[model samples]
Target: SQGEGPDPYDEILQAFKIMDTEENGFLTLADLKQICESVNLNFSNKIIQEMIEEADNTGDGKISLTEFTSIMCQTGRFKYCAPK
Candidate 1:
């Protein structure tokens, strides 16, 4: 039963994958904007840019999987945290 259940981490990975439409191993502003539109979030560019800035530890103007996971693990109900 343990192995049969879907892992929570898998869901996060899927979400990141969906956001990275170009499969470039990173989430760009355009990619995030498209995802927001698809989900009907209606977030303006300013807000979305701010969101990107908040999570972009590397200051590369894009979110790598590692950066995304760090934010996800830091907030919400996830108990794990990315290693420093």
Candidate 2:
């Protein structure tokens, strides 16, 4: 199953809240690296670069909240589950 029943937008927003420490609408490569580190997810620089390029829709060096959320869902890293 995909997981919980919360609205996808809400899920995305929650992800954004977690990633966007600066409260800015965009995330830098450093931000992505930090997230990877926090999750103990070992990722190569090439993979990170590809993720940024694939996820950063605006063509800017940073990724927007929406973009980040979409990537997370697509990657199965974030699953919406019921509260335990």
Compared with the true structure, all predictions reach lDDT values of 0.86, 0.74
- Please provide, for model 2 over 1-84, each residue's C-alpha lDDT reduced to its tens digit, 9 standing for 90 to 100: 256566656766877777776777787777777889899997887788888899888898788876776677776645543333
Relative to the unseen true structure, what is the Cα RMSD of model 2? 6.0
lDDT of 1 by residue, 1-84 (tens): 387667677777888898899999999889999999998999999999999999999999999999998888877755334343
| Model 1 misplacement above 4 A | 1-4, 79-84
| Candidate 2: residue 64 lDDT (0-100) | 83
The clash tally of candidate 1 reads: 0
User: Could you say which candidate leads in TM-score?
Assistant: 1
